[model samples]
Target: MTFVVVQNSNNDTMTRRELHQAWGTQKEKLKLKFAALTDTDLLYPEGMETEMISKLALKLGKTKEEVYQIIKAI
Candidate 1:
C-alpha cells in the first residue's frame, strides 16, 4: 500500500494513513511488540491520533515519539 508522509510541528516524519493501515495489516505483530496492548487499544477514532498515541504510551510505557516510531515501523 502507498502512504503519504507528513512532517509534524516537531519535525517528526510519520505516515498517518499508513499507520492505521499497518495497524490493520500488522495487528498481531503490534500486539507482540506491545504485549500490554489490546485489540480495543488499536482502534483509531477519526482525528484521534494524539489520543491513540497517549493510550499507547501509557500502555506500553513508551514516549510518544517511541510509539510513533513503532507505528511508523509497522
Candidate 2:
C-alpha cells in the first residue's frame, strides 16, 4: 500500500480541534485520498469548524468522530 507522508517540520499531527492550524496540508491530503472531494467540499473557513466537519461527514457517510480520525491519520 502507498503511504502518505505528512511533511511537517515538527512531524507532529494536529488534533481535530486544531485542524484549522494545519488545514492547508490536511486538505491536500484529503484531496489525494479521495478524488471525489473538491476544494468546495473542504472549504474550512475560519470560525466554521463545525460546518466543515458536518460537510465532510455528510459527503463521506461517516460520523464526525470518524472524520476527525481520518484527518488525524493523515
Candidate 3:
C-alpha cells in the first residue's frame, strides 16, 4: 500500500485517506497492537487527523504523540 503524507497546521504529518485505508487493511494488526481498540475506535473523518489521534489516545490510554507515532509507523 502507498501513503501520501499530509502536513496539518500544527505540523503533524499523517496520510488521512491512506491511514484510513490502512486501518481497513490492517485492522487485525491494529487489534493485535492495541487489543482494546475496536472498529469504532478506528473511525477516521476527513481532515480530522488531530481528532482521530485524540480519540485513539483516549481509547488506547496513550498520549496523542504516542498515537501519532503508532500511526506513522503503520
What's the residue-level lDDT of 33 in candidate 2?
A: 92
List the candidates' TM-scores in order. Answer: 0.72, 0.72, 0.67
When summed lDDT is taken over every stretch of 10 residues in candidate 1, the lowest stretch is 1-10
Residue 68, candidate 3: alpha-carbon lDDT: 75
Give candidate 1's root-mean-square deviation (CA, Å): 3.5
Highest TM-score: give the candidate number.
Answer: 2
Q: List clash counts for every candidate, in order.
A: 0, 0, 0
Query: What TM-score would candidate 3 get against the native?
Result: 0.67
What tens-digit string does per-residue lDDT give for candidate 2 at 1-74?
Answer: 22333323345444344666689998999999988899999998676666787799899998877776788788
lDDT of 3 by residue, 1-74 (tens): 44667664557675767767676666666778888888887776656667877888888888887777776666
Error of 3 at 15 (Å): 3.9
* Model 1, global lDDT: 0.73
Show the colliding residue pairs in model 2. none
**Model 2 lDDT, residue 68, Cα:** 67
- Residue-wise lDDT of candidate 1 within 2-70, one digit each (tens)? 465645456777666756655676667788876777899888865577888889888888888887767
**lDDT computed for candidate 3:** 0.72
